[model samples]
Target chain A: MKAQRIASLTFTALAIAYLAGAFFIKEPPLRQQLGPDAFPKTIGVMMLVLSLLYVRIEFQRQPVKEDDERAAIIGAEEKLSDYVDYKTIGIMLALMLGYGLAFESLGYPLATFLMFMAGIYVLDLKHWKRDLIIAIIASFGIYFLFRYALRVNLPIGVLKFLFR
Target chain B: MDIWNNIVLGFSVAVTPFNLFLAFVGVFLGTVIGVLPGIGPMTGIALLIPITFGLPPNSAIILMAGIYYGAMYGGSTTSILVNAPGESSSVVTCIDGFEMAKKGRAGPALAAAAIGSFIAGTFATIMLMILGPAIAQFALNFGPPEYFALMFAGLTVVTSLAGRSLVKALLATTIGLAISTIGIDLQSGVSRYTFGNLEMLDGLEFLVVAIGLFALSEVLANLADMRQAVMERLSIKGGLWLTKEDWKRAIPAFIRGTLSGFFVGGLAGAGAAVASFVSYGIEKSTGKHKEELGHGAIEGVAGPEAANNAAAGGAMIHLLCLGIPGSGTTAIMLGALLMLGLQPGPLLFQQQPDFVWGLIASMYIGNVMLLVLNLPLVGMWVKILDIPLYLLVLFIILFSFLGVYTVNNSVQDLLLMVGFGIIGYILRRLDIPAAPIILAMVLGDLMEQALRQSLIISDGSLGIFVTRPISLILLILAAISITNPYWGQLGAFFRRIFGQKTAA
Candidate 1:
């Protein structure tokens, strides 16, 4: 499917899913008439309408010579979509999440070092030695800046033994 | 007596050696990043926010404001040099700016943009100094219903002007309002969307959402292509003087653009981008040299550059006066102000006169400093743009992480920043405008609180919005504001029918 159609359908699905979840929100006993659910309920409905409108516009845009026209449009859209570099982006995202989780356990310096190395590798830069050195300097540099200069604490984790 | 004393107090705060240093640093850095392709004032401000984390509110705002107009001035450099607008606000400058550069007129073009921006910035700052205090005094008379109506009107204006489609803007606004309802209900004290998590109870930090949505998402979008701006090394040496004929065309445009940009940008949601675009169209129509516009017209760079800078100054007025941010960048500024535990509204003028006046005074100084910074440092600005995109992207991500962490000190906030980054990237792919979402998010709490309070006063009566004169006037303005989107289409439809009748 073309990205336009796929995007429209995705919003439609999102709106429906949001509304479905809205129904299960347990209100406080004897809440105000315009209760906590009112705003969300309005938003869900509006999202559904807007998404369907978007989908309608997309469909209405297609001519009767649908197959060939759609193929051409999809071809152009696919060319655009290929720019995302999804493999690298996915790796970058995964590394970030992992780094976030490991931040408390492995410490800011260590986790940032590993994350930066993994991130640079994912982006297809091959100067691993330089990257590692740079990453080490950066991680420690930022850790000290936040800890001392800015007076914010970054958890030291198991490295506290060595530093102390 | 009051205005004079206020100015004195403000100048006193701003003229301090420490504050002067802060303003210089802001403008200097703002100009450097603003010259970079694909990085405008918005992203520049977001990335550097952590630098101001430990500073007092007055100095912090002074620095951010300097960066704003500094970037506004810098955006034109990219347009002239590389035909790339660092931000949408400077998009119009590329039309004639690059043509002039190609014709070996880059020096005059750059000088015109800088000088026009300085003049407009000074003019607009004066207007802000006048209008900001006046508006705050007027708003002091407002009640809860009026406040609610004013916020609603703001959203209405934004929805009409900011988005390409009203439905899309509405959807974005509603989603933002919904997100604001996530934590414990302000009125009823019941958690709406917390879903029984301890972390969810206190609510999402605005800074986390901002860094995620604006800074991180921009990195992802740029990384998709990674096309660094290829700049040809060219000497910026040339006469700074506009030719006799050039000044004849440009001076009037500078004046007109300054006025139009100030008013348009001072309105809710219509920021520098809209102001410059509107100024471009107006400049074209008002000129006998319309033929010269697309072909290296100095007026083109003069008008749009001045308009953009003026708009930056104009945007600050509404934010400082009413606490309702007039544009997306100011909305982020509002969030920063909130984080500092300072409320910006009518009472702010009365309460913290020094802070308010000092910020105003700093704008005057910053505009002069930007002119000094840009005119002599063109070579340095050009070199700053030589930094590779991949390196900048990495630094952007790293700074965003630091900023989000600084705000909440939670690993969860970092993850949420990534989460919002991905979501923001998807929204961009879908052709959804992000400004409305951010604007609504910033306004959401105050909007809801005002509404509930008005309702409580009226025993849940919605008519209270219409009964109050101020509220009624605001609601009427909102209704009129929506006509902006459809006015052109409506005019054309009527013209078709009327033209047939006239021909018969």
Candidate 2:
């Protein structure tokens, strides 16, 4: 698909998804008056209108002649979608998932270390030993700062037993 | 008398050893952040937000305001020494200021900018002291319609935001609106676009987005360029002072720039960038030494710096009076207010006299502190470029993540931070103006609330927007403001036509 077409379609898909979500959520009793679904329905309608407008604008724009086009976009093959360093994105998502899962099990320091190490690697930091060491130290330091210095009791999870 | 009393109280509050230390630290760190190519004032303040939880609100605000103006001061350092502007407002400064540096007149250029900023900043603080309460009273009348019209005016003027492609700018704004809808709806208590995650209920944090877009993306852009850091041979080649002729030429430009900037800065939608551009244009059009403009004119440095600082002061009027932030940096400051559990409105003036006056008083002190710090410390700031990029990046990332997570002690917020970072990266790659997006997102909720409240009062009649006198005036002004740009273009067209017809 052309860049403009893809952008238009993506917006349209978002609009449709919003509407679909709004429709799927069950309505509440009249006595309740408002519920979880009410706001979504309103926003879904707005999104649909905005998306339709975007699509219309995209479709109406005339493609420039090859010779007349500006130099700004000539060599710029990447559009919005192409810019998402997906390798990093995927790795980041996985790290977040790991942190979420480990939050109640491995505890703050351990989970934070893992997340930071994974993030540094995912972002493609060149130095392995340095990045790993720095990530660990920083993560642990942050954990102590928040848990001890600020006195915000973080979830120790299963490690609560070990500390006891 | 009240203002004087407040200043004394503010001085008493600010004189605390801890608060004083923080103010110094804030400026010093703010300068560092400003000098770092991608991290602007918004990021600097947002990064400092979590740390303030430990300090008094008055002290935190004092420090944050220091960061805000200090960043502006630091911005010119990079623009003067290197061609790169550390802040968007300083982009214009590079054109002539860098030229001055190449001609070995960097000392005079730096001195002019610093002194010009000091003078304008002090004047602005006084203006704030006198005008803040009066403006606050005027802003008390703002309703939903007025706010909508004001935002509309702001959004429309963004076209003049020193960028190409109006379509792209609007697209950026729409995307901002879309991002803003991600959190739960306040009115109906329904989740709009949370995508089934409990964490998404709060939406993406603005700080994460700012850092990712402005800071991380900048790092990526810099890394793409294989050249090592740009630094120059530094030292005062001669006595660091402006010549008599330079002074004679600069004073007029300085005054003109300050006046223009003051008005633009006070207006709802006007900001430093526009003020700087207007000042530069005026100086070029009216200066006695026109030939020296692009070739190292001292007036060039004096006028734009004065204008930029004046505009910064002007922007605070809206923030203080109507609780409207005219720019991205102010929006972050507003968020900081919210985080501190303070509502900014006219009632805030009547209710929290100390908070309001203390902040005004702090601006005066902060400006003085900035001049003291910036003059002798220019050499230290220049030395910052020598710091290894890897170490600096690690520290920035570490601090940012720590700040985010520490705010709520929530792992969920950390995930949101990362999400915003990715979103920021995507936005930057597409060349969208990030400031409008952040500003729109911040204001979106308030805009909706205002709209809804107005409707309720009117019993569902939309006519309520224009029924009120203030609302009607605002609507007319918005209409005129939007049309004025086109009229300007039309006048230029007619001028061209008449010139050609007469010649023929």
Candidate-wise lDDT, in order: 0.79, 0.69
Deviation in angstroms for A125 in model 1?
3.8
Name the Cα RMSD for model 2.
5.4
* Model 2 ranges with Cα > 4 A deviation: A1-5, A15-164, B155-163, B202-216, B219-236, B480-504
For candidate 2, lDDT tens digit of each residue in B1-504?
777787787677676677777777877787787777657787788778877877767777778877887887888888888876777777778878899888888888888888888887777778877888888887777767777666655655643351333444455655566666677766656666677887778877666666555555444443333133445544444545789987898889889888877887546456777677778888888889877798889888898888888888877777777787887788788777777877677777888777777777777777888888887778788888775555555455556656766566566766656556655655556444567777767776776677667776777677887788777777776567545535866898999999999999
> Candidate 2, after superposition: displacement of residue B408 in Å?
3.2
* Residue pairs whose backbone atoms clash in candidate 2: B265-B314
Q: What are the candidates' individual DockQ scores?
A: 0.30, 0.16
Q: Please list the Cα RMSD from the true structure of every candidate, rounded to 1 decimal place.
A: 4.4, 5.4
Docking quality tier of candidate 1? acceptable
True contacts kept of each: 0.33, 0.06
Best by lDDT: 1
Interface RMS deviation of candidate 2: 7.2
Model 1 over residues B264-342: C-alpha lDDT tens digits? 7554446788778778888888876888998989889999888888888888877888888877788888878888888
TM-score of each: 0.91, 0.83
